[model samples]
Target: MGGSRHVATSSTHPGDLHIPGSHRFYCTAPCLSWRGGVGMRGSVPPPLIPVSPSSLLQPEPLLLAPSGTSRPAGSHRALRGSLERESFKPSSQPEEPKHNRRQPSPCPRSVVEAAKAHPTFGELFQFATPVLMWDQHFSPETWNRLKERHVPYGWQGLSHAAVSSTLRLLNASANRHLFDRRRFPGGCVRCAVVGNGGILNGSRQGEAIDAHDLVFRLNGAVIRGFEEDVGTKISFYGFTVNTMKNSLIAYEEYGFTQIPQAEDLKYIFIPSDVRDYIMLRSAIQGSPVPEGSDKGDEPRKYFGPEASAEKFKLLHPDFLHYLTARFLRSELLNMQYGHLYMPSTGALMLLTALHTCDQVSAYGFITANYEQFSDHYYEVEKKPLVFYANHDMLLEAELWRSLHQAGIMELYQRFQLENALHSAITPQPKRLAPGQDKWEESLAWRRNGLN
Candidate 1:
């Protein structure tokens, strides 16, 4: 009689309570809170019937049998009305963008310049002689057996098929570095792998030269007043014995009396002759230059004790296959190079850089309007981009354009970037030496497909 609670009927209102079959107990004060444990001692009452609004109010004490089972101290299911109304569902996740790829560490201008003061083994390895090989891929055994193992990492002992696939991936990844694709967040890093082409002289790209992250030059490419057209920075310089000599002799009038001096510019040697190998080996051992009749006077000075020839990086053979398989199609490969067989030197240099640099932007290369410039920057006359028996220029151009379209490279057009760098202008007829004319004739014959 002291404290028994009862509910009479069930109602939709929050304050109205029900206890089924007992006497009516209308809740008129406020909402009620059920707390503490309720023991299940007696049976529950019958189901309650809802009262209509017209029914009269009753105040009878309803019997409230503690029907709730007593759960263990921590095992109670405490369900709040507010919590029960909220629906639970998993949320959708966002997709990551493709541009989030590997990033290369940026080498600052100051650091790059600082590296120039000390000439490493690369600088000392002055001789670049071309090493020619047939289409036959080298076996892993063959590479391991070589006197000096020059293959890049991860390329040793791979089967031809495996090597083919791996190089394809590498080439694909490298091509991604050549453009402004979403795969490369760093945007395009244009590199002008400038050859000693006389064609660049009157092309009018002097002042409007393309802006790129790096520039590679070879041999005797003199960029004095044409700095605007060719940019002032010399990032990478490549050389071979014959090519470097040719550059010096050919471009001497183009302000190339001495090699372009840069604090951080790297000198890359292209081995094209057997003598170059001997000279380099001697230089590495700090020995005197070999005694050959053709050897220059006082060759010992070229390979002094300070020379470090072994540090120079050589191109991996797999890299050549990667290039040949992708760009140099079979038809172009069969294109002969005079009495000997080889790809264009400029093409080879640029291709090597494509694989080496993390990002590449090309400037001062042949374009659709290649007819607009002299054969070389220091040319006395405007010369057509003459095809030679020594190399295939048209095929190279086609490859460049294809790579550009595939987002693999950036080719600076002759007229497009003229105002960006220092350049010169002239109009002259095409000319060639007596011995070189034969090469042009052979080039024309190849163009006509004589064989």
Candidate 2:
């Protein structure tokens, strides 16, 4: 299998580097315009603290379940037994009839009211409705819109037959479990979006994070030793096919031997590549990956034996586009990184929770004080967080801070919660100016072979 690669070249301008393979560049020249020719001559942001090459984690060799080996029957029974134990047991006091139970409202009134009060919040609601999932059959328009704006690596020349086959498989699956009032009894659903930032270390927020009705975790979510701080419950695991595979290879030493598995847990597949669609189909059907980079791979190894269509959800490509255009739009887009640019998995999962849940608390997310924490809580030694060209961490940090001040969500800011909140709301017209420098530094690190 041939994988895609990005090659960078130095340009005449300082901090300007060209990625020929992806046709993207890092523009540092003051006169250069970005994103619709907007002048970016303001002060450049500070450089990201770089980690030595030896400090960076290396991914292990790719491994999959042997082609013909089936998931052991004992594991299935164990999962089934665990589900039965966790199943909701109704109260003895009289149960509401199925018809009488409160059904989920088509549009949540609280969310609407909140949006009306905050223009930024309202804009997000308009762009991406929380109630719907971007499945192949249920959202053709969304799927098409996504295909036009987002190009997954190695999928530029994907055949029409391949697309159709994947969609056909997805169309046959069941719908996702959106916010249902019937399940919660009360109208509100609380959620926690947990990023794997090292700030979570010693935060002792496990009980708080797990208390929410649902919890969303992504990429290298290590829980074994850090349970007291990061929580043990994982209701949803969100990732692109690339991130999931990369995490397994890179963070396997950190205990992410396989994707999170539970009878009721759902996997949100961000369709960054055709491989995601192919893998999702194989997982649901209990078959080996039919073709592509993951050909002959068994899905049951990641998701247990009884994996079903109900356990998988695909993010609509349109929704991702909307997120980038409206909220996390970074200068990187004009640099030609649009094809590779997508919100960090943490950002996507948090936004999903915000749109769907009545109340949300974010744990281990990026804040102004991110430098104080390690790159990830699971690291044996403290490692400085490194910024990469593919993501706009500062933009995300600003958004999270703003959301917290607006009473939209509670971002766990560790010891600097109050300070972070204050700075988020403070008017700083020159904030982005200083932040732009970080991207340049990130590019420098990549050029130095530190990716």
Candidate 3:
């Protein structure tokens, strides 16, 4: 970081930050309600979401049986994003997006002080007892105990063999921290978690995104023709097996025909369904999927044939539970539809970065003005963002907004030029809560010092 460079603040809101002289930086912000299409849990399914197989979610409704009864056919899988379209023809390359933005040198960030300054971070951090589950943590006792809980926390309906085998194979790799601290040695390691929000459509943030030490991308991350906006580098790709396949099927027409593959790129599996464990096992063994919805599916088609266990990571169910319980505890959890709730894939990845990286920037994620743009920036046609019953995206938005205000993370938000300029010229300062004043005062100090 250059001494001359100073932290910038958004005139419209205290949470959003603008890097002085930098190409607008931050990654991911799209909370699509694909969860509405997920099979309802702990009860009967809801009315269909009017989605087709071609949609991002295939819509398989699950019906859980009584404690003593045999599980329903669909009960085996925790999630229902399995059905995919047969006409999955890849779309012609989308028109190449254009860019004229220049990137400034990197600005440093630290989550330590920022998280401490936050009102709820201490409480939330307590729940992160174990963020990633590796072989060393797996045991018959652990499995039996976890099995008592529901999905994303326990393996209730999943196979003991499948779970054990997967954990065993993760003996050495994919079970530890995301990256080596030795890589940065003694510096603030910055990360960018890119999303599929429409805000990044023309943001021209590609260069700035690649500037981070690590970049995380999730579901339907269409990058081919949009490199000018989302960047080409992917140090990590986060998704469930369902999402990876679903994105390929549902987004092929948008030019996302394949998942990103590289020798160094690691895959983070959320373990949302049995398909993820099965697929991960197969991928690590260099074999075809043996059973389940993706039976016979060749791992080579996705991960390169040489891909090893070192290239995959399985997020701990404990972490997922902690995130839901502590951070984005949506109201839907109390409803009949609550069982279907899970944080969007993007939310999971961004949170993962926050815990692992010194600093995180969320790009293309949902903002207050989400209605102003389509669901996805790369959609050939403009499709309004759908609010499905499966995910309470609005709640996630509040968390992101608060995290921004707390200075725990930087979420790049775009306001209309006229409005931004207007706010800049005639600011209407809101009554902030206690401790929030520190954020504003800190920004002011930096801005004044830079001047």
Each candidate: RMSD: 37.8, 18.2, 17.6
Candidate numbers sorted by lDDT from highest down = 3, 2, 1
**Candidate with better lDDT, 1 vs 2:** 2
Candidate 1 accuracy as TM-score? 0.48
Error of 1 at 243 (Å): 1.1
TM-score of 3: 0.71
Backbone clashes in model 3: 10
Give a tens-digit lDDT track for model 3, residues 158-271: 889988889888877546778766677555689999999888888999999999889999878889999999999899999877567657756777898888898889889888
Q: For each candidate, give its TM-score against the true structure.
A: 0.48, 0.67, 0.71
Best by lDDT: 3
Q: List clash counts for every candidate, in order.
A: 45, 4, 10
Expressed as tens digits, the lDDT of each residue in 158-234 for candidate 1 is: 34443332223222222223223353356434455776565455556544444555667766667777665565667
Per-residue lDDT of 326 in model 1: 32
On residues 1-451, what C-alpha lDDT tens digit does candidate 2 reach at each position? 1354333322111122344433223333211222222323433222222211111111211111222333233322133222211111111111112342223434344434555477435433442333234343334543453344333312234455565565555542344444345677666777899998988988899999989889999977878989999999988998866567656665777787888899878888876667777888788789999997678988898889998777777765445544554455554443323233456789989987766677788998988667667878888888766455456676688677767766678889865455457666764222322323332222232224322
